[model samples]
Target: MTEFDAATAIGEGGTAELSDGWVIGEAVNGGILMSLATRAAAEALGAAGSHTDPVAFSTTFLAAAQPGPARVESQILRTGRSFSTAEVTISQGETATLRHTATFADLDANSEPVHLQEAPPELPDPESCAPAARGGFAEKIRILDRLDMRIDPATVGWAVGQPANDGEMRAWIRFADGREPDVLSLPFFLDALPPVTFTFGALGWAPTIAFSGHVRSRPAPGWLRMRITTRNVIGGLFEEDAVIWDSRDRVVAQSRQLAGVRMPSAPVSP
Candidate 1:
């Protein structure tokens, strides 16, 4: 099995052990945790004779998850000829860490197509952009080394003390191991970008409260182009919206998340 499949593997009774290699400072990356849940949900659907693929997934992070054994309990909420829905809860011992709901469907190949949106945002070629600089924060979190990310120079002024008027960040991202994009990997890509909050002078970690994303279509091979934007920050909370476009220039997924704005001096919840 591939490294991803092994990391996300579910055993008898829907249990899995998260590997320490996937941990970031004190907790496993939220995206990696969500991907495990998504994989378990898909496996449940398939075992029930449903051939559909996950098209949408939403998850709420209720607690931090350490690198250890966890259980993924899934239930099929509904199943029809065209689509299915499932709920998955990932827990360690008896405490739930993440809960997710997913909708799966078989994509129609002969359906009529309509294009309403324009092309994706323009940015310098990935080869021309430099890899994102790893600061002290990254030194403490080794998980950042597992991703190959190149950020648009114009969008990184905040790193040098110049905050952008609008909180926006654009980058090209892919696994450092060169794994091709897939439905399960999409969650990781969506959550992998440096928080848009950084562009607006919020430098500390932005812990996600809730995240929702939709997979419009299967991704084409190659690096993903992504854009993340934050419109407002109020009372130490903010919302981040993101779009992921594949190498073909087609939007494969989009996501929005609500996260707490944590500062260096602020107290963090366990």
Candidate 2:
């Protein structure tokens, strides 16, 4: 593995800030922003990846952050032989945006049994979905104009013009200027979409409280396909479970998140 500049930014006050490229809904994607903060946390603790060592990461999104310049700070919770734990906080202006906890671990050989539990659903070709025409990450954060997206028609493909990660959402992501897609390259996958969930009348916008994932496998580059569907929304909280697949129908990484609905701006459980 090679070292790359963290997708997230370091805070002037020792906190990580949101990338100017990250925008979501009325605000930036807190999940992605928080994920980067966790990465910064790992780097601060000297647990980041190197040419020979790769680290697994898990993160939590504690609050919804408005769009603006932001910052993040991390604390090393603990370090063990196989894994290290860290906590991070994200801020916009002065108000706290999100808090995250993460774990980084070096890979090791184990004789445990392996299993493939889930697979992507058969969906239309990415070209078949409706295309969004949003511009850069600044104007439209949630709007994707890259790959085709169909919430109702629902299949697996990319959401071009959005974050691109080999997952449940096939996003047409262009790298920064001269950057190329690689393992070390930061993949900007939108882990959360609040408006879609709110439009369903199930619950409106809910700030993400936390996000966590275990690295089961790494992905290959090129345009990828991602599929996501809301499974449950209740008690002022909603959950999204997603699956990611590559061009060859290969299952990539899997991720899930839980968010809290704050009403009006969000949804009431009634």
Candidate 3:
């Protein structure tokens, strides 16, 4: 099995383990947690082949999920000839980690004409971009080590106390374990980067409260380039948006998230 599959595999009784390799700070990455729940959702819906792709999902991080065994409970909500939906939840013992509602459909069969006003960001090749800045808050996110990540140096000013204050970031990423990104991994990749708020001078723990995303197409093998931009910051809360593009330049996914953040003056969360 691929690293992602193993990290998110569901066992008997809908049991699964959150791997430390995907850890960010003291908890498993929220995206990985969503993956576990989505996998279970797909299973509960008996999704397979072209019909197995989780086309869209909206999840709420109820509590921090530590690395270890967890259980996924999937309740099928609807099943039709074209799509299936499920409500999935992950729990570690008595604590609820997250709840995800997802819809599965056949991406291969969606041949409708594409009309997109959003364009892909023009970024330097992964080989030319700088590797993930290694210091300060960025260094502490362990999941960065599990992926081959390269950031545009221009957006990394926040890493060195000279943030551009633009609330934007662009980067290239792919699994370090050689796992090619597929439809199921799009949501994980959408949340893979550091909070874009870093570019606007807020550089501490930014725990996501809600995340919603859609997988537009299956990704092609190779590095995926992504752009993240903040929508607005209202007091201590902010909303961020992200878009991912495959190696072939196809729009793979898009996401929006709302998280509570520690603006620059506050100490990092423990």
Candidate 4:
């Protein structure tokens, strides 16, 4: 099993171990926490039922998680013919660190046509871009070792002290361990990239208050392309919207997050 598979695996009664390998800074990556909870939820649904694939997931980060043993708790909210709802929580000992809720269904049975969908953003070949985890942010994000993330050069001004101030970023991402993207890995991919606020030079400890991700389809195997954008940054808060396109350019996942941030500093009068 890959490191990701190992870290996300829960044995017995939802017991799991959060690894230091996925740390973003001092805390474990929020997406990793989501992955752990999602696994527990999927397991709860079990192989006996058709409602096994996660269609949507939402999580609230109550506190930062550190590398250590954590417990996962899952509750089946409702099981229906078309959809099933579940609640999962990741806690360290007696302290709860994150709470999650998700909806599941058999994706294979979902062949409905798309009424409206956005085309994938145009990007250079994965090899043509620069690694996403570099420069100032590199020092803070340790998860880079496990991911092959290449950022579009045009969107990498922030790393070179020339932040675009446009609140956007695009990148090509995949596992450094060569594990292919699948339904279970979608949550991680959605939240794995550097924050969009980095485009404005606000790389300070911007904590995600809440995150929601929707899985539209199972991704085709190959490198995934990602585009993250923000339309507003106000009142010390920013919202980031992300979309992931699979190898075939199909939109596989979409996510939005709200987080507290420190806006770029203005000139100080001498």
Per-residue CA lDDT of model 4 for 1-270, tens digit only, reads 998899899978778888888998799999888988888888887743638789899999998998998889889998899999889989997789999999998876773566677798889888799876555757668788889999999998987799898888999999999999998899998888888988888767779999999999889889999999998787888899999999987888999999988876662111
RMSD of 3: 3.4
User: How many residue pairs clash in each candidate at the backbone level?
Assistant: 0, 31, 0, 0
In model 1, where do residues sit more than 4 Å from their true spots? 108-112, 263-270
Give the number of colliding residue pairs in candidate 3. 0
lDDT, residue 40, candidate 3: 84
RMSD of each: 3.8, 6.8, 3.4, 2.6
lDDT per prediction? 0.83, 0.48, 0.85, 0.86
* Maximum-TM-score candidate: 4
Q: What is the Cα-based TM-score of model 4?
A: 0.95
TM-score of 1: 0.92
Global fold similarity of model 2 (TM-score): 0.66
| Winning model by lDDT | 4
Residues 202-239 of candidate 3 have per-residue lDDT tens digits of: 77779999999998887899999999998677778989
* Ten contiguous residues minimizing lDDT sum, candidate 4: 261-270
Q: Indicate the residue-level lDDT of 196 in model 4.
A: 90
Off by over 4 Å in 3: 47-50, 135-139, 265-270
The TM-score values for the models, in the order shown, are 0.92, 0.66, 0.93, 0.95
Native-to-model Cα distance after best TM-score fit, residue 193 in candidate 3, in Å: 0.2
